[model samples]
Target: MKMLPSKNLLMTLLTAWIALFTSSYFFYWQITFSSQFTHVFVGCLMLLLIGFVYVKNDFVEFEMFNLKEK
Candidate 1:
């Protein structure tokens, strides 16, 4: 199986790192997100995104077709 593309891998890691730092900051400070519901929603979405990216990177491979999607 072929590896994931470098550009896509960098982007995925970058997004996950930003999300991880942001969420960790909030959790570390024990901030109440009751008033900032949007942050909570975004955090949850980012969590799923991070998990998906991690799984895809580690366990999945994409089919290549002339260097682009088929």
Candidate 2:
């Protein structure tokens, strides 16, 4: 009956992650290969983004399977 504590934060994080990867994928597929400097920059940026997201939100995910039928 209650909502998750960080649903919005997770949504925002997922949206940002999708957007960043989409742009990078577009560039990689449509344009030339990215340079090492670009790779380093994006990697650092992604790490910082993930770190910030991790620190700012309380989120966890898991999977469940029910072998017994109801």
Candidate 3:
């Protein structure tokens, strides 16, 4: 089987998209419920960190899911 072009780029883009979406959701949550900017910022940071860790650990598995070896 032939490999897809820019596989790494695709993986990176997916990871970034996940991270951004998660962090944005958390930020929105914080802003909706929290009155303080500090709290919202902290929540956003935490969510982003968590997303980064998740993506770092799972990206390889995710990439491998659709990849076929020749």
Candidate 4:
């Protein structure tokens, strides 16, 4: 029923990009070590990056549901 905030949308896109790259790198490392630790590390890194961006940008709206829980 409503539109997403421009900055929030941009942040979401950037976060997705970050996650995509991180996942790719994780898979690459998985081939080398044949272990899941690196994947977990990459996941943690993605979470940290996303959390930092969200906190810094204050993207408090849910674009899909058009809800503001803040």
Candidate 5:
């Protein structure tokens, strides 16, 4: 039987996908929002925050599993 993916791996993959999508979306509208530096910066900051949370949650889950197995 095949095993399911770990939380960390899934979160990493999702974060990558989200980053790519956000970058492409911003790039696509670059011409229209060329002067919106604050918006772009805020968007990037939010994405980073989201990624950090996911990674942290994954780490916590991993730790919990390890503790349970011991």
Candidate 6:
């Protein structure tokens, strides 16, 4: 079967999206407990780490759902 052209791009984008969601979750929890800026700072750092992982690994593979062979 032929592979889709946008598959890898979609995977990368999904990874970024998930990272954003997770960071936001931390910020949300942080805001309830203490100062907004402090949590946001930590959240930003977490997001950056997530971004690094995606970039360094070059789109992590989900073997179960991936249609194409790596």
Clash counts for all predictions: 0, 0, 0, 0, 0, 0
Error of 4 at 32 (Å): 11
Tens-digit per-residue lDDT, 11-66, candidate 1: 99999999999988877665566747877888999999999998787654543443
Candidate 6, which segments miss by more than 4 Å at Cα? 1-34, 59-70
What lDDT is reached at residue 56 by model 5?
100
Q: Which candidate is the best by lDDT?
A: 5
A best-first ranking of the candidates according to their lDDT comes to: 5, 3, 1, 6, 4, 2
Each prediction's RMSD over C-alphas, in Å, is 11.8, 12.8, 12.9, 11.8, 9.2, 12.9
Per-residue lDDT for 1-70 in model 2, tens only?
9777698899999999999999988776644357667888899999999998876554332112232322
Estimate the lDDT of model 5. Answer: 0.92
Per residue, candidate 6 scores C-alpha lDDT tens digits across 1-70 of 9877698899999999999999888765634545767768899999999999987666455543465653
Using all chains and alpha carbons, the TM-scores for the candidates as numbered come to 0.37, 0.35, 0.37, 0.36, 0.51, 0.36
Error of 6 at 46 (Å): 0.5
Q: What TM-score should be assigned to candidate 6?
A: 0.36
For model 5, the superposed segments whose C-alpha errors exceed 4 Å read 1-35
Q: Where does the lowest 10-residue lDDT sum fall in candidate 4?
A: 61-70
Model 3 misplacement above 4 A: 1-35, 60-70
- Candidate 1 C-alpha RMSD relative to the actual structure: 11.8
Which residue pairs in candidate 1 have backbone atoms (N, alpha carbon, C) closer than 3 angstroms, thus clashing? Answer: none
Residues 12-64 of candidate 4 have per-residue lDDT tens digits of: 99999999999888766536563567778999999999999897666544453
Across residues 1-70, which tens digit of lDDT does each residue of candidate 3 receive? 9878698999999999999999988776634444677778899999999999999879887778758552
Q: How much RMSD separates candidate 3 from the native structure?
A: 12.9
Index of the highest-TM-score prediction:
5
